[model samples]
Each structure stands twice: as C-alpha cells, then as structure tokens.
Target: MKVLIIEDEKELSKSIVEYLSEENYLCEVASTHKEAMKKIGIFNYDCILLDITLPDGNGLKLLEELTNENKQDGVIIISAKNSIDDKIKGLQLGADDYLTKPFHLSELTARIFSLIRRKQFNNANKIKQDELEIDLLAKTVVVNSNPVALTKKEFDLLIYFIGNKNRVLSKSTLAEHLSGDFADMLDNHDFVYAHVKNLKKKLSEAGCEPYLKTVYGTGYKWKG
Candidate 1:
C-alpha cells in the first residue's frame, strides 16, 4: 500500500516511514502544506497521515481540497490536537480516522490496514473471485486451492489490479504505484511489463484464467 505522511516533524515522519516500510508499505513524506498539495495533486495514495498544523497551511484545508476533488484516498489525521472539536472537524472534512500524537506505531499500522480494507475490500480480510482467493492479512494468493508464490512487487501489482478491476491503468500509473516516492527517478516503465508478464504466467500456471488484458496502445486492464 502507498502512504503519504503530511507532517512537519522530521524525526516523527522518518520513524513512521521506517516502521511502515518494514511493514511492506511504500511511504512518501511532505513536510509543508505546499509539498503535500503538490504530491496529492500528482499521485493517489491508499492512505494519508495528516497533521493538523503545517508550516505553510492547515491540514484541515487540505482535507477540504480532497473532498472538493472527490478523491477516494483514505485519510487519517495524526495531529497533536486531541480536542473533540478538532477530531470532529477532521472527520467532518473526510478523514476516516484520527490518531493523536505519542501513539504506538503498531496501532497506527493497524488503523491503516483497517481503513484500506474497509475502503477497498469492504472490510474483508480475504477476497475471492472465481477460483482465485487472496488472503489480505497473510498477503498470499491461491488459485484452484493451490498456492501461487509471488514476489512482493508482483503481489502488490496483483492487488492493485484487482482493486481497480476493469479500469484501464496506464504504465505511468502502475509505475507510480509501485515506485512511490521514487517514481520520478524511474527512467522508464518497462519494469511494469516484466512484473505483469510474470504475474500472468504464475496465475495461469496455477490454473487461473487470464484476467489481465493489455489495452493495445493504452495500457492494461483487469477484466474481472
């Protein structure tokens, strides 16, 4: 999953990124409201950890912008402000959850997983489609009751495709999803082709129908 940490506290942001990265989440950090706005405008994240106070602007304003844009990214406000009004305001603005400062990273990780599951998979830990079964918590995929081993990047790619099934996903978008903050450093998206090819081969060998389709001049789509 991809996460955006909109925090001015450099040390806290670093710690969160390190911890979440260890948990298999790709993280990006934005220290100022301007930087956050720029990143949000360009990329879509699975979850956003927002701080109410920023150096350039208020985090609440950012929430308002997201609402106005009708963005579906799940947001969790990680603010020092623990007042009821602040929490209410953040929720009213569209934050899915609120976490006060000095909280446990494990708890934060759990909240992020819960929010993503609720938003993407209807709060289900396992997602089934035809003969394919995906265990979200275990991060495993099975076909015809047989396990299909996949690389971490391949697994992430499969989940992303399944989540946005039938939608035409461009190579740039896929690369961004996979590369996260380092997406800009990518010279080309040829790695996407390799991963998709390998994933398709694995699934097919595991007795799964081909659901991933190439869109000719466009990109690729999950036909499921």
Candidate 2:
C-alpha cells in the first residue's frame, strides 16, 4: 500500500518511513501542510498519517480539506495532543484512527494495518476470490490447493488486483503501485505489461485458471 506521512519531526518521520518501506509499502513524506497538500493533489494514497501540528497550518484543517474532497484514503491522526477534544474532532472529521505522541512504532504499524484491513480487506488478513486464496502475512498465493510461484512485483500486482478485483486498473496505476516515485522517471509502462504477462504465464503453467482480462483500450481487470 502507498502511504503519505505528514509529520514535521524529521527523525520520527524518517524512522516511520524506513519501517513501513521495509514492509513493502510505498511511502512519501510532507513536513509542511503545503507540501502535504501538493502531494494530496497529485497522487492518491491508500492511507495518510497526519500530524495535528504542522508548520504551515493545522493538520485538522488539512483533514477537513481531505474530507471535503471526498478522498477515500484512510487517515490516522498522529499528534502530541492527547486531548479528548482533539481525538473527537479528528474522528468526527472522518479520521480513521488516532495515535498520541511518544507512541511505539509497532503500535503505529498495527493501527495502520487495522485501518487498512477495515478500509480495504473488511478487517481480514486473508483475501479470497473464488477458489484462490492469499495469506497476507505469509505473502503467498494458492489456487485450487496448489501454490503459485510469484516474483515480488508479480505478487504485489496479483494482490492489488484481487483487492480491487472488479475494477479496471490502468497501466499507470499499476506502475505507481509497483515502482512508487520511480514510476514518474520511467519512459514507458512496458514493465507493467511484462510483469502481467509473466504472472499470467506462471499461473497458467501451474494449472491455475487465468482471471486477468485486458480491456482493449483501457486497462486490465481481474474478474474472478
């Protein structure tokens, strides 16, 4: 998943980014409200860790803007303010969770997982589609009782497709998910096609029915 962390504390933000990146999450940072706003305008994030106190503006105001935009991204307020009023305000403004300052990184990570599970996976660790099953923790895929071998990108692509199974995902969107910031540096999205082709071949070779479908001029979808 892609995450945007809006924390002004450099050391803390770096630590959070490093930890999440190690877990295979695409992460970006915004130390100021303006920077965060620019990022929110340009790219979509699965979740956002927002600090209540920002240099340029109140994080709560930013939350208000995000809510007004009807952005579907999950928000978790991370702030030094331990006031009940702060927590209540954030929640009433559509924040998904709240974390006080001096919190353990593990706790933060767990909260993120919980928020994502509730937001995308219906609070489940396993994602199921027809006869296919994926263990989120194990990072493995099984189809018809047989394990399917998948490279990192292939696995990420498959899980992403399964998570939003019925929606048509564009090549650009796939590239962003796989490559993060480097996606903008690429000249073409041929890598996405290559990965998809390899994944399809592997699944087929493993005797798994291919549910991936190309939509002519648009994109691809997993219709299972």
- Give the candidate number with the greatest TM-score: 1
Residue 201 lDDT in candidate 2: 91
* lDDT value, residue 150 of candidate 2: 89
| Candidate 1 deviant stretches above 4 angstroms | none
- Superposed by TM-score, candidate 2 places the C-alpha of residue 64 at a distance from the truth, in angstroms, of 0.5
- lDDT scores of the candidates, listed in order: 0.94, 0.89
Instruction: Count clashing residue pairs per candidate.
Output: 0, 0
> lDDT tens string, model 2, 1-224?
88999999999999999998877778999999999999898778888999999988999999999999999889999999999999999999999999999999889988987888788888889987776788887889888888988887898888778778889999998998887778999999999999999998988887677789988778899986
Looking at model 2, residue 181 earns an lDDT score of 70
TM-score of each: 0.98, 0.94
RMSD of 1: 0.9
What would the per-residue lDDT of candidate 1 be over residues 84-147, giving only the tens digit for each residue?
Answer: 9999999999999999998999999999999999998899999999999999999999999999
